[model samples]
Target: GCFWHHHDCYLFKVPATRTAFWLDKIAKNVARDRRDIGRLAEQGWRVLVVWECALRGRKKLNDDELGERLEEWICGGGPCAQIDTQGIGVLDVTSPPYRM
Candidate 1:
C-alpha cells in the first residue's frame, strides 16, 4: 500500500481562477511530500518521486523508453531514483542527484 499513499502525485498547475489559493495549496502539498519521504527514508524504505511533468508534455520520453528505464530501476540495486526531463534527455535523479 506504500504506492497508494498520497503524495505530490498531481501536477498542481495554477489555474486562471483562484491562483493564490492554488499556489498555497500546492506549497502545502509539496511540504507534506517532503515530510512523508523523509519518514519513509528513516524506516529504510526508499521512495521515487517522479513528477507529472516528466511523464507528460512535449519533451517527455516515449512510452517504450520510459518503460525500459522503469524496468531497469526496479531490477537494479538502487535505493531510490526519479526520472525527469532536462533539456533533450531524461534526468536520472539517482545518478546526478536531482532535487524535487
Candidate 2:
C-alpha cells in the first residue's frame, strides 16, 4: 500500500539463490525504480528509501534515531532521499533537496 500522501515505501530484497536470475531481476527492478521515481517526482511527490542495512546489522541505526530521521525527512520537505549504512555510501538521484 502507498504511504501518506503518495509516498512509495519499498523494502527491496534480492534472493541469494539463482544468482544470475536474481541479478537480472534486481537490475530490472532498479531501472523500474528510477523510472517510477522520476515520474512521481514530476507529479510533486517525495521519496524516502530506507535500505535494509539501515535497519539491521552492526552498522544499523537505532529505532528511535531512524524514526526521527524519517520524520524529519517527511516533514522537512525533502524531495527525495535515502537512509543507508555508512559502508553502503549514498545514492544521489538528483531531485532537489535530495541526499543519501
Scored by TM-score, the top model is: 2
**Cα deviation of 40 in candidate 2 (Å)?**
1.0
Candidate 2 C-alpha lDDT tens digits along 5-51 = 11122433444678778667555556666778878888998777776
- Which candidate leads the pack in lDDT? 2
Per-model CA lDDT versus the true structure: 0.52, 0.57
Residue 79 of model 2 has an lDDT of: 76
Per-candidate TM-scores read 0.61, 0.64
Q: What's the number of clashes in each of the models? A: 0, 0
RMSD of each: 6.7, 7.5
By how many angstroms RMSD does model 2 differ from the true structure?
Answer: 7.5
**lDDT score of model 1?**
0.52
lDDT of 1 by residue, 1-100 (tens): 1112222224433568887776666556555665666677779985665655557866566787777767776676355566655322322333212343
lDDT (C-alpha) at residue 9 in model 1? 28
CA shift at 58, candidate 1, in angstroms?
1.2
What stretches of model 1 exceed 4 Å from their correct place? 1-13, 87-100
